[model samples]
Target: MLISMKIVIISSLFPPNSYGGAEQIACAEAEKLAREGNKVIVLTLKFDKGYACSTSDAKNLQIIEVSHKNIFNYYNIGKKSICLRFIWHIIDTFNFRLANDIAEILKRESPDIVTCHNIKGLSLLTPLKIKKLKIKNYAVVHDVSFYTPSGLIEWGKEKSWEHMGVLTRIYRFFTRRLMSYPEKIFFPSRWLLDFYYKNGFFINQEKLYKPNELGFVCENKSVDSGGKVANNFLYVGKIEHHKGILLLLDAFERLKPTNVTLDIIGNGVLMSEVKKHAQTNPNIKIHGQISREKLPEFYRNAKAVIVPSVVYENAPNVVYEALSCGVPVIVARIGGACEPIIEGKNGYIFNPGDVDDLVEKMKKYL
Candidate 1:
């Protein structure tokens, strides 16, 4: 059966103004829908007024950039203290200007389905507005941002700390209870939905797991070690403590596999630390930030991609990209990192934050 639908895709960040995995998935899904004969409109935040609050129809997609300046960026918050960053996180969610812009669009478009991806930069009230308009609303939980300010559940902390802060508690109430009230909600992986459920989310609402759709696909993917390289382990994401980079470094240093090498890509606050380690270690290569066009080459030329995230990641796009190139993954046993990997088949999973466990998993390729 052929169906034509009006779909309003809402995300806080879009491509060319990337935030992370959420933007990549949102943009790709929206474009895919537009190509499938649906009338699609993408609502995303635009910090620069020069972009304008106008519509552009290209490749069968309509993009509406809502004009709003984020307080964190306006103050240049890189390398700032945790307290200051938390303040920014609070302000980012309770945005009223972006809300008005989206609400007005909803009124005019009156789309059949209001599909929301990430609403951190915009406002969580987006789905509420959609419901108010009596439209079928769907939301995708690509992150734990609704529960925690940084979307990270710190490792080794007691669960008590999760609801310790008043701001976090309030945010959780809205995100966990109110936001989950959408007509339907999607999780990219079972681990993600389970994580939310274990934390008391999805109260009296519909939820399901839908694997993230990748932007590209490689043909003739094989289970054999048929990638371009045999002994190269790759890590593509932020270099941060909560991401388990420090633990990975320590594990790699202590393990010291004689025949294999490790490659680190992307940027973050821990650049200096990674650079220092790269200076001391010859096997560890720091590529900084590589262009998107050059990413596949890296994935193809690697034995396996390492996702050592200690936080509760939803479904990392790196894993999808790696799989698309027929490269296996060695993932941490937390969050969605372990969801895609099939032990002894496609990839291996090790206890998160456990150096010895990671070393054992890495040795399989080494």
Candidate 2:
């Protein structure tokens, strides 16, 4: 027997506007719930020239896009000055306006379960609002944004929740207090789950180490051309310093192996630098931001996918995607990035920030 209930999912972003794995997962979760005969409501942000609000419905799902009332939209945070960014975070912390908007939707929908993902832009006080309505609220941890606004901790440069400045300490104190409103929380990896627990964030809440859902299974679509396995490698992610794009490029250049190629996907602030490297290295190809539906073609042909993130990731989707496609993975051993790799069976792991270790591992497929 199957039972269907009304569910409301709140995320900062949703499909079409989704820029990362977290948003994709939220969309998938909503669709799955709707397909199971449940009425699903997704409350997310709308980004336009003026941040317009709109609503639409399809099948058993309804999407309500609320305009953010902060100084600027969340997507423009990178372009703002430090002072403006600080002010924006403060406004977003409590976000009375945004909470009121979401509260209205929750009250109308009166959902059975309220699940939230990456509520940074949506509002940190979202869980508290849901609880105020006496609804069962659950949150999913996607990254380290709760600890730091940037959601980043460099592998070699940053300390582990230590040596916080006064402002940062104050920020975390309030963020931690507000986030504790969730009845139960889900984490994509044990590293992230432990991170929150160790920082004394969600001490009384029930925590579960639930790995990210694949959303869709990929079929092995391409047959290998039958050549040297290491001849062609793939990297799919943001092209930025924290993602270790430069490090991967440097290693590939050092390898300097004949007939070897590296296909880089995705785009970010480091696009110009990546382009400069691509211009210099004939063996490296930059395919900027391939659609999700078209990624399997690249995965099936490549010998292995390399995740060279220097930041402490909370389990990336690429590793799982590659393994599901029957391709091996060579990942950096930092945070939860290396959690899924079984070493020699599915993939291999190298010490983070170690060029020699990465090159040595790259040699195996050569």
Candidate 3:
């Protein structure tokens, strides 16, 4: 006999809040699971404008929005400091009130399994509360940066990192104590899992799952290729230093391919620099933050999509979105970006941060 289970997905961001890739994946997964005949529900933070909280069975899914103002909105060096991090952690510990509220919902719903995606905006206190309640829980780590507080302290902005020093060290020391509470830990990439294992963060590798292998489904249908006329190469993602946006711009400047253009989507702190580069160079066009509905059009019209992220991204939705549109990708050889691309087959790869190699690769595509 087969038994059906009810799943409660906890995330910090959800649809209508779509801040990054983690939000998109959580939305997609919840919808998919709901369609699969399992009762699915999502709990996410509420935006300032507020979100609609009601039962929508249209997609066989239930979306529950819990309202909470995000304290960490923009990058504040003071707030991100080690002393601040500790203070924030102490304050966040009181977020057990929010977790207890979530626990009440879980008890009322009586879900068989509690699955959590990104909860950076929410609180880790919720999971611990749920575990104490004796609920079967799974926490999915989208990125390794959050596992240890030191990871954030090291990789975050210099000012923030400096502020986070001693407090972050303390947090890192106690991370294992908090982390070991989770019954199951889900990692999107083998590379991430191995990295954590090597770092002694995660001992049991069996808990990690490579869900990216299943591939993502694109909601928009692929546009007919015959009518598309643009010869532009697309790069869709946040314009951060870690994303290697500057590297891409440098490479594109070096190539200087006549009649070819580069369309950059999304906005970030480095927007001014990127804009300055675009102003001097006529070939680069910056389209800041396009809606998900409009992304298909960008992918379809592009000659190819470029993913030049320098950091080890677990699995970027942009790559999946591009491939789903049948648009070939030219991604950096580092991280999980190279997982989908078969070199010359569906896409191409170049050395991370190598402007010359990237320029050569761009020229070949042009």
Q: TM per model? A: 0.88, 0.93, 0.84
lDDT by residue (tens digit), candidate 3, 245-282: 99899888888788888899998889999999989988
Q: Where is the poorest 10-residue window by lDDT in model 2? A: 50-59
What is the per-residue lDDT of model 2 for residues 97-119, given as tens digits with 9 covering 90 to 100? 89989999899889999999978
Model 1: CA > 4 A from native: 1-3, 48-58, 73-94, 158-163, 219-229
Clashes of each: 0, 0, 4
Clashing pairs in 3: 81-163, 81-164, 82-163, 82-164
On the 0 to 100 scale, the lDDT of residue 249 in model 1 is 88
Instruction: State candidate 1's TM-score.
Output: 0.88
Worst-scoring 10-residue span by lDDT in model 3: 69-78
Best candidate according to lDDT: 2
* Global lDDT scores for all candidate models: 0.76, 0.84, 0.71
